[model samples]
Each structure stands twice: as structure tokens, then as C-alpha cells.
Target: MSSSDIFIGETIGTAILILLGGGVCAAVTLKASKARNAGWLAIAFGWGFAVMTAVYIAGPLSGAHLNPAVTVALAVKDGDWSNVPTYFAGEFLGAMIGAALVWVAYYGQFQAHLTDKEIVGGPGAQSTAAKSVEAQEKGAGPVLGVFSTGPEIRHTVQNLATEIIGTVVLLLAVLTQGLNDAGNGLGVLGGLITALVVVSIGLSLGGPTGYAINPARDLGPRIVHALLPLPNKGGSDWSYAWIPVVGPLIGGALAAGIYNVAFA
Candidate 1:
């Protein structure tokens, strides 16, 4: 594919991916949304559907490598780095755009959720409440989950390991199952199978660090969250940000190495 095609395809595809995926989080987390309290199953399935939809729409144009991890894995597998930067640029840009769209779609719900003194914590908070926010700030803000992933139990080693393992599973599926066809793009059956794989990963491994197997998926929205104007949204949790970015890249490379040795 041409650079323009790859860029536009990834940009549009990843935008849809993050829109629907993050939209689920906002729906379940925000107070006013009807899907509120829909639980983890809803999120897992929602993300799977999002991936399916994005892949089908963008596959023909750019092969729909919407995640940086996927792009890196494909590059490693094909020994082709020519378009990696274009793919990465589109992925991150699309992610930020999609996240902003989510904010726009759920502006009122965000206002309601964040402005609640109970959620934001303030001078009126009990000592325990203040302590709770303090602890959360170290990893993520209350509303940050809507934009990015964070660990449930903050252990650097465990959180990084979880991301790597989840990403390896995802990349393996993509590499072996013809989901992306070695960066050529996604086929219909391959897209569906890949989406199911994502859902499976989420259900089995998402509890730890929300299974951020895609670096752009986590970091792009986190950047948007830091920049966007939201009242009392709390810290962006910069401290825990590096793991999601680094772990997924490592996982992609590792998956590609394994594929080269065994599948190639």
C-alpha cells in the first residue's frame, strides 16, 4: 500500500477502534449513561466488536494495523520498516481523535461523574477518602480509566509482565491466523477471529493492567486526557505510563521473534 493509504486507513480505523472501545468505558463508568455498571464482560465484548468494525472498514485501505504493537510485529516479520513511521503516526493520531470524540459524546456524563465531590475528593472528604485519592493518584486518577489503562495492584514487575503476555497472545493470533496477513491487511474471517482473540485476552488477562497490548491505544488517549480541559479530572498518572508503552513494544518484538523461529 502507498504511504497515504496506510496513513489514512490506520487513522480512520484506529479512530473507530478507540471510539467504540473507549465509549464502552464511558458508558459503564459515567453516571448518566444507560449502560452504567454494565460490568467487565460488556467492556471485553465491546472492544472485540470495535476491533471487528475497524478492521472491516480499514482493512482494504491500509491493512488495518491500528495498534503500534501490530505494526511493529508486522515490520519485524516482514523485515520491512519503510512505512512503520506512517503507520505509527496514523495510529496515535487516530487514537487521540477517537478519544476526543468520546469526550465529546459523553461530555455531560463526564461533567457529572467528575464534579461529584464524592468522586473527585476535596476538603470535605473524610480522612480515608483523601487517602484513597492520594493512593489512586500514584497510579491513575478516578476518571483516567475512561481514557487509559491502569493497574489494579500496582506492582511494576507484575503490571509490565501482564501487558507483555497479553500482547504476545494478541500478536501471535495476528501473525498465525492471517488476521492481518503479514501487514497486507485483514480479511473478513480473519478480522472476526482476531476480534474474538482480543475479547479472549481481555476476559482472561485484562484484570491486571487492563490489557493494554497496544501502545498507541494507551498512550494517545492518556496524552489527550492530560491536555483536555476537564474539571477535577485528577492527575494523568504519568508515573505508570511507561509500562504500557514499553511492555507492548517488547511483546511485539518477542512475538515476531517467536513467529520467525516457529511459524515463518
Candidate 2:
């Protein structure tokens, strides 16, 4: 495919990926949403469906490698570096756009969730006490979970390991199954398989770090959370941001290496 096609496809696909993925988080976490407290199973399935939908939509235009890790893994697997930057640009830009759209979609719910005295601890209260124990340990503010993932425990080693492990599983499936080899990236069956893989990763390995198997999925929305003018929205947890970004990258390269040695 041409570079323009790749860019547009990645941009559109990744945006939809984040919009629906982040939308579920907003629906479950925000107070005013009818799906409030819908729980983790809902999130896992929601994100899985989001992946399937985006892949099919953008597949025709640009093979729909929505995640930067997937893009990187393909580059590593094929030993081609030329189009890496284009894919990266599209993924990150789409992710940011998608995140901003989430804020627009959930504006009132966000306001209600953040401004509640019980949630944000009233006006002028900057304390972390109102946040969950995990958020407090991670130094994240209330409502940040809707925008990004945070560790339930603050162990650096375990959190990074979880992300890496989950990503490896995802990339392994994509690489081994030839999911990206189609004229339409991740064709019908491939999209469904990959989506189910994501759900499996989230259900089995997401407990520690919320399974941020995709770097763009986490960091782009986190950046949005930091920039948005949500009332009383707390810190972006910058300290922990590197794990999701770096861990998936390493996992991608590792998975590619394994594919080269074992599958290729």
C-alpha cells in the first residue's frame, strides 16, 4: 500500500479503536452513565469488539495496524524500517483524536464524576485519599482510570512484566496466524481472532496493570487526560507511563524475534 493509504488507514483505525475502547471505560467509570459499575467483563468485551470493528473499517484503506506495537513488530519481523514512522504518526495522532472525542462524548458524566464531593473530596481538596488504594499507591487522581491504566500494585517489575507478557501473546497470534497478510488487513476471520486474543489477554493477564498491550492505547489517552480541563481531575501518573510504552515495545521486538527464529 502507498504511504498515504497506510497513514489514513492507521489514523482512522486507531481513532476508532480508542474511541470505543475508551468509551467503555468512560461508561463504566463515570457516575452519570447508565452503564456505570458495569464491571470488568464489560470492559474486556467492549475493547475486543472495538478492535474487531476498527480493523474491519480501516482494513481496506491501510491494513489497519492500529497499535504501534503491532506496527513495530511487523517492521521487526520483515526487517523493513521505511514505513515505520508513517504508521507511528497515524497511530499516535488517531489515538489523541479518539481520546479527545471520548471527553466530548462523556462531558457531563465526567463533570458529574469529578465534581462529586465524595469522589473528588469537595472543592480545594487535592488529597489522594478519595482515590482507590491502587490509585493512591500509583499517585493517580480520581477519574484517571477512565483515561488510562494504572497498577493495582505499585511494583515496577511486575507491572512491566504483565504488559510485556500480554503483548507477546497478542503479537504471537498476529504473527503466527498471518493476520496482516491480507489485501484488507486483518480480514473478517482474522479480525475476530485477534479481537478474541485481546479479550483473552485482558481477562487472564490484565489484573496487574490493566493489560496495556498497546502503547498508543495507553499513552495517547493519558496525554489527553493530562491536557483536558476536567474539574478536579488529578495527576496523569507520569511516573508509571513509561511502563506501558516501553514494555509493549520490548514485547513487540521480542515477539518478532521469536517469530523469526521459530516461525519464519
Candidate 3:
């Protein structure tokens, strides 16, 4: 495909991916939403469906490699560097756009959740400034999980390892399963299988670190979380940002290497 086609396809596809995928997080985490407290099963299946939809839509143009880690892994696997920057540009741009749309879609829910008496301020509660300060000091944030992932335990080594392992599974499966070679991109069956793999990873390995197997999926939304104005949204937790990006990348490379060594 032409560069324009690749870029446009990835942009549209990743936007849809994040729209639905992050929409689930908002539904589960945001207050006043019908699906609030919908729980993990909902999130896993929701994300799986999001992947399926995006791949089916964007696969024809860009192979639907919406994650930077996936793009990097594929490049490594194929020894093709020409289109890496194109894919990255499209993915990141699309991710940011998707996150912004999510904000718009759930604006009211975010406001309610952030300004709830329990979260931000109350008679016995801290002021917004105090909350922000305290959260920064503690390296914590509120309502960010709707947009990005965070660890439940906050163990550095273990958290990083969890993301890496999760992403390894993701990239390995995509490399081995995706029919990116056939037709324009992921075949219909590949999309379904890959979507199931996403759900499986979330159910099996998502507990500790929220299973951020895609760098763009996590960081783009995290950036929006930091920039978007909402009442008492708390810190973006930049301290923990590196792990999700770095770990997934490492895992993608490892998966590609393994695929080349064993499966190629």
C-alpha cells in the first residue's frame, strides 16, 4: 500500500481501537456510567472486541499494527525498517486522537468521578491542591486507570516484568498467527484469533499490572490524562510511565527474535 494509505488506515484503526477499548475502561471505572463496576471480564472481552474491530478495519491498509511494540516487532521480524516510522507516526497520532474522543465521550462521567465527594473534596476531605500534592508525593493518581494502566502492588521489577511478559505473548501470537501476508493485512480469521488472545492475556495476566501490552494504548491515553482538564483528576503518574513503554518494547523484540529463531 501507499504511505498515505498506511498512515490513514492505521490512524483510523487505532482510533477505533482506543475508542472502544478505552470506552470499556471508562464504563467500568467512571462514576454515573451504566457499566460502572462492570469488572474484569467486561474489560477483557471489551478489549478483545476492540482489537477485532480495528484489525478488520485497518488491516487492509496498514496491517493494523496499532501498537508501536507490534510495529517494531514486525519490523524486526521482517528486517524492514522503511515503514517503521510511518507506522509509528500513524499509531501515535491515532492513539492521541482516540484518547481525546474518549474524553469527549465520557466527559460527564469523568467530571462526576473526579468531583465526587469521596474522591476529591468533602467536609472531612482534603482540598484539590492537597489531593494533588499528596498524590504526587505518594506517586499515585485517581481515575487514570480509565485511560491507562497502573499497578495494584507497585513493585518496580515485577511490574516491568509483568508488562514484558504480557507483551511477549501478544507480539508472539500476532507474528505467528496474523495473516498480514495474505491480502492487504490481517485476515478475517487472524483478527478473531488475535482478539481472543488479547482477552486471554487480560484474563490470565492482567491482575497485577493491568496488562498494558501496547505502548500506544497506554501512553497516548496517559498523555491525554495529563493534559485534559477535569476537576481533581490527580497526577498523571509520570514516574511509572516508562515501564509500560519500555517493557512492551522489550517484550516485542524478544517475541520477534524468538519467532525468527524458532518459527521462521
Candidate 4:
């Protein structure tokens, strides 16, 4: 594909991917929504469906590489580097745009959810009543998870390892499945199978750091979270940010190396 094709395809594809994926998060997390408190199974399946849909729609355009990790892995596997920057630019831009769309879709719910006066107290939370306005400004609210991932336990080592291992599984599956065969993009069947793999990873490995197997998927939305005008949206959790970015890159590179050594 030409540079414009790559850019436009990835931009639209990643935007659709995040719209559905992040839409699911908003559906389940935000109060006043019908799907609120739907649980993890719902989220896993929702994200999987999102992947399948986005891939089918954008497969012919940009190979449906909504995730930066997948783009890097393909480059590594094929020994090509010309389009890496293009893929990343489109992916991040699409992600941020998708996230912004999510906020718009759930504007009312977000207003109600974030402005809630109910006090939140627990381990890692300060003991006090719900100070929604203050919490939003100080970046100490629970709303960040809706837009990005955070460790349940806050252990850097384990969190990073989880993301790395999870991303390795993702990239390895993509490489070994022969999904890259098509001149157009991930085959229709390849898209379905890849989406299933994503669900599997979420079901089995998503407990830690929310299984951020894609760098753009995490950082781009996190950037939106920071910049958006949401009320009481806590800090973007920048401290844990590098783990998602670094771990996935490492995992993708490692997967490529392993594929070259053993599978190629």
C-alpha cells in the first residue's frame, strides 16, 4: 500500500477498533448505562468483537494493523521498516480520536458517574468522602480505567511481565497463523481467528495491567484521558505508562526473534 493508503487505512481502522472496544468499557463501567457492572467476561467478548469488526472493515485498506505491536511484529518478521512511522502515526491518532468519540457517546453517563458524591475508600485510596470535583482535578479518581489500564496490585515487575508475555502470545499467534498471506490484509478468516486470540488472551492473561498488548491502544487513549474535558477523570497514571509501551515493544521484538529462530 502507498503511504496515504497506510495512513488512511490505519487511521480509520484503529478508530473503529477503539470506538467499539472503548465503547464496551464505557458501557460496562459508567453508571446509568444499561450494561454497567457487566463484569470481565462481557468486556473480553466485547473487545474481541470489536477486533473482528475493525479488521474486516479495514483489512483491505491497511492490513488492519490497529495495534502498534502488530505493526512492529510484522516489520520484524518481514524485515521491512519503511512504513513503521506511518502505521504508528495513524494508530495513535485514531486511538485518540476514538477515545474522544467514546466520551461524546457517554457524555451524560460520564457526567453522572464522575460527579458522584459517594465516598470511595479502599486499599490504595485515601480515606475520605467522595470529592468528585477535587478528585477530578487532582487526578485521583477511578475513571482512568475506563480510558486506560492500571495494575490491580501496582507491582511494576509483575505488571510489566504480564504485558510482555501477553503481547508475545498475540504477536506469535499473528505470525504463525499465516494471516499475513493476503496481498490485501489479514484474511477474513485471519481476522476472526485473531480476534478470538485476543479474547483468549483477555480471558486468561488480562488480570494484570489489563493486557495492554498494543502500545498505541494504551498510550493514545491515555493521552486523550489527560487532555479531555472529563470531570473527575483521575491522573493518566503516567507512572505505569512506560510499562505498556516498553513491554509490548519488547514482546513484539522478542516474538519476531523467536519466530525467526524457531518458526521461520
Candidate 5:
């Protein structure tokens, strides 16, 4: 595919991904009436569906690299350093656009359901509100709240480890799926495998820190949450933000290293 085609496909695909992945977060967490806490299963399957749908739509044209780590991994695997900048830029831009749409699509619902007071409380309260809304909406038996970082801000090492492991699994799966195999085109089988990988990561390891396996996925949406005119939004939590970015970069690089040793 041409560079233009790749760019367009990646942008649209990433937009759809964040729309669905983050949309679910909003749907369950933000919407007051119909809100339902999207458990690990929901998050896992939502992302799985996001990947499946995005790949189905854009994989043929752009390889559907909605995640920056995947694009970086592909560049490293092929030894093509020149396009690295362009691909990363494309992925980042796409992720931002996608995240923006997710915020927009769910903004009204989020506002309607959640109070301004709830948003300003902190990330923990904001997340809790989301879970409460989701439970009420779905009429679920009981709301399941998953807390990672507390208000006091302890457990730096644990959070970093969580990010690292999450990113490692994400990149390892991409590498194993032959992202660079021009001859091995991605079909339904490839899509299914990718979906399963995402589900596995969420179920087994997403307990701490909501498994932000993609840097762009977290940072981009967090930016939207800050900039968007949400009534009671708390601080963007920018202080602790570097861990996700740095951890994922290291994890992706490490996964590449391991893949090279085992498969290359």
C-alpha cells in the first residue's frame, strides 16, 4: 500500500479502536443510567473486538497498526529505520484523533450521568462513578470496583511492573503474529489470534493499573479528558503518566529482543 493509503487507514482504524475501546469505558463508567462496569472480560473483549474490527477494515491497506508499539515493532523487525518517524507520527496522530472521538461520543452521556463533584474528587472517584453507573445501567447484581493507585500515591514499583508486563505481552503477541510477513497476509485467523491475545492479557494481568498496554491509548485519551469541557474532571494525573509511556517503550523493545533471540 502507498504511504497515503497507510496513513488514512491507520488513522481511521485507530479512531475506531479508541472509539470502541474507550467508548466502552465511557458507556459503563460515564453513562449514569445505563452504565455498567466493564470488568476485565468487558475490557478484554471490547479491545479484542476493536482490534478485530479495525483490522478487518484497515489491515489490508495499512496493516492496522493502531498502536505505536506495533508500528515501532514492525520497523525494528524489518530494519527499516527511515520510515520509523513517519509511522510513529501516523500512529500517534491516529491515536489522538481516535481518543478525541471517543471522548466526544461519550461526553454527553458522561455528563448526564456523573455529577461535577464526582469528577473533581480524583481518578479513583471518577473511576468509581463510572463503575457505579455501569452497574445501575445494566442492572448487574453488584458493581465490581478495581482500584490500582490510591489517593496517597504509593506503590511506584508495582505500577511500573504492571505497565512493563502489559506492554511485553502486547508486543510479543504482535511479533508472533508475523506483522511483517508480506507473504502471510492477515486474515480472519490472524485477527482472531490477535483478539485472543488481547483478551488473555486483560484477564490474566489487567488487575493492577487498568493495563494501559498502548501509550497512545492512555496518553491520548487522558489529554482529551483534560481538554474536553467535562464538568468535574480531576487533574490529568500527569505526574504518574511517565510510567506508562516509559514502561511500554521498554517492554516493546524487550519483546523485540526476545523475539529476535527466539524466532529471528
Candidate 6:
């Protein structure tokens, strides 16, 4: 594929990915309907499936780097560094746009469930309250709200370490499965690998802080959370944002190091 064609394919494929993956988050967390938490497992699987779909669609064209970490890892692995800048730009921009669409898709439900007055107690009390109310109203009754990485006021080292480890595992899986040519069509294997990685990270290390292993995934959606006129949206939680970026970058580099040593 030509450079332009590759860029466009990646952009569109990534946009679809974030739209579906992030959209599921909004649907479960922000939507006011009675079926709010009907599909936590489904949401997780949706993300895995989204990756599969995006890869199938754009892998041939631009390698389907929907995440910035993936782009960085590819650069590190192949040393084809010239396209790094372009790929990063496309992935991040596509993530931002996808996040915006998620906000739009769930805007009405969020507004209907959460009000301005309920969101103004302590730090992030608004988001907490909104999430609680959304659950109660939907009859899901106290579903955990979606996780977010907050300021580094507490457990900075632990959080960063968790992100690093989480991202290392994620990248390792992608390298072994995502970039592999298993001849028998590795799409399903790749999807399962991603799902298992996410589930493992969420179940084990997702206690104190949510795992934001992908920098673009966290920052892009956080940007939308800030810009969207949701009822009583809290601060974008910018303070803890850097860890996701730095941790993933470090983790991807580490994974590359390990892969090079072990496989190269």
C-alpha cells in the first residue's frame, strides 16, 4: 500500500476500534438504561474483538497500529524508524476522535442519569456519584464505575510499576501473537491473547489503580471526558496521566529488549 493509503486505513480502522471499545465503556458506565451492567464480560470481549476486526481490516495496509504502544514496539522490533512519527500521529489522533464519538454516543444517557449537583463532593466525588447513580438507576445496583488513572498523589511507585508490568505483558502478548504468522490464521488466537491479558491485568493488578497500559487510550478518552459537557464531569485526572505514557513507553522498550535477547 502507498503511504497515504496506509495512513487512511490505519486511521479508519483505529477509529472503529476505539469507537467500539470505548463505546462499550460508556454504555456500561455512563448509560442510564436498565441494562447498564448487563455485559461486563461482553465489554471486555468486545475490546478483544475490536482488535481482531481492526487488525483484519488494516493489518495488510498499515499493520493496524491502533495503539501507540504497538506502534512504538513495531518501530523498536523492526528498526523501521522512519514511519514512527506518522504512525504515532495517526493512532493518537484516531484514538481522540474515537473517544469523542463514544462521548457523543453516550451523551444523552450520561446527562439523564447524572446531574451537576451530585458531582461536587470531594475529589472525583462527582464522577463517583454519577457512576453510583447510574448503576442504581439502571437497576444494576452498585456496579463499579469504570476505572481511571488519577493524580499521583498516592502509590505513585506502585501504580507506575503496575502499569509497566501490565504493559510489558500486553506487549509480549502482541509480539508473540499479534505479529506472528501462524499460517493457520492467527486472528482468533490474537484476540484470545488480548482478552486474557486484559482480564489478567484487571483481575490482579487493577485493584488500587486501573490499568491504563495504552497511553493514547487513557489520554484520548480523558481529553474527551474533559471536553464533553457531561453533567458534573470531574477534573481530567491529569496528574496521574504521565504514568500511563511513561510506563507504557518503558514497558514497550523493555519488551523489545527481552524479545531481542530471547528471539533475535
lDDT of 6 at 86: 73
Q: Each model's C-alpha lDDT?
A: 0.91, 0.88, 0.87, 0.84, 0.65, 0.65
lDDT of 6 by residue, 1-264 (tens): 456755676677777777877766667665465557756465666666666676677666676666777777767887867776777777777777877777677667667655534432335565756654554443322212332344223577887888888888888878876463422223655655665777666566655556677777777666666666655454455666688788888888888778778876
TM-score ranking from best candidate downward: 1, 2, 3, 4, 5, 6
* Cα TM-score per model: 0.95, 0.95, 0.94, 0.92, 0.82, 0.79
lDDT of 5 by residue, 1-264 (tens): 677777787777777877787766656655453646655577678878887888788787777777777766666666766655555666667667776776566666656644544432335566755644444343221111110121122377888888788888888887887874782336678877887788788787777767777777766666655666655444456666677676777787788888888889
Selected candidate, larger lDDT, 4 vs 6: 4
Pairs clashing within candidate 6: 119-126, 151-240
Q: Write the per-residue lDDT of candidate 2 for residues 149-201, one digit (tens) a residue.
A: 98888899999998889999999998987856644577788899999999999
lDDT of 3 by residue, 180-208 (tens): 66535768988999999999999999999
Candidate 2 vs candidate 6: the TM-score winner is 2
Query: How many clashing pairs does model 6 include?
Result: 2
- State, as a TM-score between 0 and 1, how close model 4 is to the true structure: 0.92
Residue 105 error, candidate 4, Å: 0.6
In model 6, what is the error at residue 160, expressed in angstroms?
0.9
Q: Which regions in candidate 1 have their CA more than 4 angstroms from the true location?
A: 122-132, 179-184
Cα-lDDT of candidate 6: 0.65
Per candidate, the number of residue pairs that clash is 1, 0, 0, 3, 5, 2
Q: lDDT for model 2, on a 0 to 1 scale?
A: 0.88
In model 1, the worst 10-residue window by lDDT is 177-186
lDDT at residue 233 of model 2 (Cα atoms): 80
